[model samples]
Target: MNNIILSIIFFLMLSTIVFLIKSKKNISKLFLSILIFVGVLIGAGLLYLILMIFDNDTNISDTIKTMIPLIASMVAAASVVIATYNTVNGEKSSKNKTILEFIDITRDILEKGEITEKTTEILEQINSKLKSTDFKVDVLVNNGAREFFEFLNAVEGKEKIYILDRLEKCFYYEPGSPLDDLKKELIRKLKSNNIKDMRKLWVNINQLAGTPAKNYNILYEECSYSLTNQFIEKDLVNSKFYTDSLLKNDRKIVDGLLRKHFELKYEDIPIQYYEVYRVCNNILESNYEQIGHFFRTVHRTLKTINSYYERNSLEYREHIGMLRAQIPNQVALLMFYNAVYSEKGRGMARELLASNFFGDRDDFHFENNELLRSEHFLNNGRFLNNQDAHIAYELFTYNKESNKVYNELEKMEKKVVPVDDSETKLKEEIFTHYLFNKEKILLDKFIKEFHTVPRKFDEYKIFMNPKNNKK
Candidate 1:
């Protein structure tokens, strides 16, 4: 009976130690103290047993000898249980303290209505702590998100941009954060059709990115001068005279002469054309850094969300759809132009196209001259005077017909074309020939049977056939 009781005690002690070691918890000072006391008792019990075994003169009986070790083992087991209880309760208290501290800090920042240097520091500290442990403060994080939105609603302009930058940091650091929802809200709030509002939006973006503000009049004058010169050089009549003529005079006099010449030669050019050109130049030349940063941030956020969900899942589609819906038609048009014209925005444009960010809406046009079809191509077949059309075309097409068209264009390029003809006209002729070539009559037949064709083919037919270019 005594040996059985001792065995049970020993088993309990061994189990407690094994469990504690496997749990990988830090051994607290109280636990260490108790363990030390239990060790001393065990040492004394062993000494007594040794004395009884070796010395015949020992007064301890067999039962007493057994009881000593048994008592020691029981005491050791009890100490372990008590130590574990204290350690667990202490951890609970510490965790509760940490949570409360985070709550307090968040509340203070919210009450201040602005994020200061100190606030950023505190947030960083908290982030570091949370990252180092398995602890999660989801409730606090969600509540903070709501409070942040409320605060964001109360701010505008630079302050709004500042807060958004901070908010992005918060979401970026927190794993599985509700960043997509935050981005959606930002898109809805920032999107605008009004030019003035859009300008203000870009200005704020520029400010955030530390880019200097652009002078609209100066940029407009430069664009007008450049466009007028191009027009003069491209003139079918008197092109040689204009190309040969040179002006050397005072700076202001030269500008005045160019202005007067532009007025006389392009009197029929609408103001909207100049306005579009000015806007494009402003975006591509003066403010691309800031605008690019804004779009890249948005793209990364969306990409992060995409990584979390299955591609074909309803959740992924719905989230992407919600973001796409927030972008108004005019805003999307601007984004399309920016993506198409700016070299830095090419990857973003491709991602936007693949994700169908432009949507399937057809009631939009670029500068009232080109019709956008199927959320991708320009319908009028004009190359827009640069590689813009080619870049856009390449991005939108990924099939055999497009490949065939490319090959045909390469072959056509080897043939002599008139020097007086603009590159836009030449490319347009190439596209027309590719569509109507006798050997590729199947493409034309496919276009005739549009209803039987795939949606992309239908889009392609609409793009290639000039008859479909209408409001």
Candidate 2:
């Protein structure tokens, strides 16, 4: 009886340790069944030993108790052992089935010889269903590739690409097969890219990426430029963000790409028409200096390409978020002032009128021009009330158009203010007094230049001439 009890205790301890070690592999509910079986076997063995030791008179019941305990323990251990095998095998079979399904789906894509929205969707669904399986598979395809051979070259073609695609398709039917191992082998084949393969690689990359206006070429160039920084080193003309498209009206896309390139590359991308081009909408309310810095850092490349330039002129005049664009109204204003300055340089006393204009004149309205009209009105109200010619001319050419603009300038301008009683102070006060009447001088010049005042200024002739016609 003592020997039987000792053997049962030893067997239970050994089985528990074995069960625990195997449990480490999966550690599922089979562990609880193993523990219960061992507990029942140990209890039965102890009970039989108690019956034997207490029944020393050798009764018929003592023999039955011992035999029943031995049979129960053997039965329990055998049942639990079989259940453990099923649990482990079930988990393995589920994993194997998942891996097989993934291999089959991947094979279908290769056999179809094309990728589509439907195909991508199918692949994603397979990824979802097979996530529980421990096998990791990542599919990498060159979106830009025209042929399988090109993709092969880009991935260095260490393993045969064409054959692998065919093999992947076949593995799906044999789910419990070596397909997982073969997929890993293909991944190994796709690791490195050579410098000579850059053009092909870039083309493949651009093909897969989507853009609203199909600016894939620009993206390809950007990727190339990022790899080499050749755009800066060679001083190449920065590529326009707009690619070849059907309608060809993508100015907004062009603007967005320009800003994105600048932000990403930190390279100077020439944004033409700086006065009108805005990098950020939020920057519109920013300080003039910050706006100026943004403009200066970006290269300005303006070209007169054709009638296309006509529609684009509107972008310059409006405030777009943080940035500002120059428009036709402002462009015409600058041109008029430049023409006036050029005339001044040429030493001409004759004030040029719209009728005398000879350069690029295409339906320019004197009143329609916003800058000219605003300046004319302001000066007429201020300095021209007193007919000061010099002041009117200076105001028209140099002064900013609005008081808000003037106040902004004053806040920016730094100068030593004059103290009272100094000689310089008196001169400043006198200049300040003259400056107040400066607008009158601008109105007088406008009257002389545009309103048909006499071109010849002779003191004796003017008195002889009609009073209204005096220069």
What lDDT does model 1 reach?
A: 0.40
Per-residue CA lDDT of model 2 for 1-471, tens digit only, reads 554765576487558646664765554456656765666677577666667567465653666555566656655665666576677668756644543444344335434543333333432332333231111100011111223334355455533454445445533434444545434433343333542233333322223223432453433322322222211212111222112211133224233432333243111211111111111111222322322322221111111111112211332111110111222222222223222322121111112121111111222223322213232222332211122223223322222332232233333322424446658767687656654444233333433443332122112210012333445
Q: Model 1, stretches more than 4 Å misplaced?
A: 1-282, 310-312, 360-471
lDDT tens digits by residue: candidate 1, 4-63: 755665676667765775675766667756765775576567556656665554444665
List residue ranges in candidate 2 displaced over 4 A.
1-7, 10-63, 116-471
| TM-score of each predicted structure versus truth | 0.24, 0.20
Residue 144 in model 2: lDDT: 17
Total colliding residue pairs, candidate 2: 24
Pick by TM-score: which candidate is best? 1
